[model samples]
Target: MYQNLDLFQTSGAMARHAGSRQAVVAQNIANADTPGFRALQVPSFSEAVKNSGVGAMKMTRSNHLHGDTKAAVVARVIESAAEPAPNGNSVSIEDEMLHSVEVTREHSRALAIYRHGLTVIRATLGR
Candidate 1:
């Protein structure tokens, strides 16, 4: 049974995080000219995972873990630390572009992990 396949779960979470980050980057770019609009950002996937307490422990059964099982890794939008311009807009196109590039790489890495995992599973299955 593949019910507990953590590899796929992790890859999926990474992809989702990258997508969410991309969305935030896009939003920041779109609001670059809006006065008082602060640039938004999502924490890195690793940070989010750590904060979400993922992989901190494993549960063999429903009651095995007494802690919260509802903790899901999610991208929480936060204000960027970039200083605001005279117009009070904090978004910098250059920074947003860089963030977009990082997101692209993260998404690619997630897909690669997922693909390699499938390949390994298929090889194990002799297929």
Candidate 2:
């Protein structure tokens, strides 16, 4: 069904990444006061989508690598923890809140686009 394609074909990947980001931010916020806790963040979805290239790639490595030779969109979490704090807690409330806002906006936008796509596909099918 068109809904399935919209959910699984295109939006699925973005949704997954968004979920990861939300989790990362939530974790950071939860550990804001925990000593030695390292704050982490998921990179932007736009960067991952852009890096996925044209969907095909030529493996030029002589040694076998453990990933898809062809670029597949993936999400990565990088430590954004601040430099050493006296109490070892590096989490910043302001920063975490800002990141949460950005992630929420991106997720909503992607969902909207995905719903629109499904609508178009359904109309074309006269469903």
Candidates' C-alpha lDDT:
0.90, 0.77
Best by TM-score: 1
lDDT of 1 by residue, 6-120 (tens): 8898899899999999999999999999999999999889889988888666555687856555457989999899999999999999999999999999999999999999999
Runs with alpha carbons beyond 4 Å of true place in candidate 1? 1-4, 62-70
Q: Residue pairs in steric clash, candidate 2?
A: none
User: Compared with the true structure, what per-residue lDDT tens digits does model 2 show for residues 1-127?
Assistant: 5544524455667777788899999999999889888889888888877877624444557575543455556787888847747887778888889988988887887788788887887898899
- Candidate 1, pairs of clashing residues: none
Each model's TM-score, in the order given?
0.91, 0.76
Which prediction has the highest lDDT against the true structure?
1
Evaluate residue 35 in candidate 2 and report its C-alpha lDDT on the 0 to 100 scale. 86
| lDDT value for model 2 | 0.77
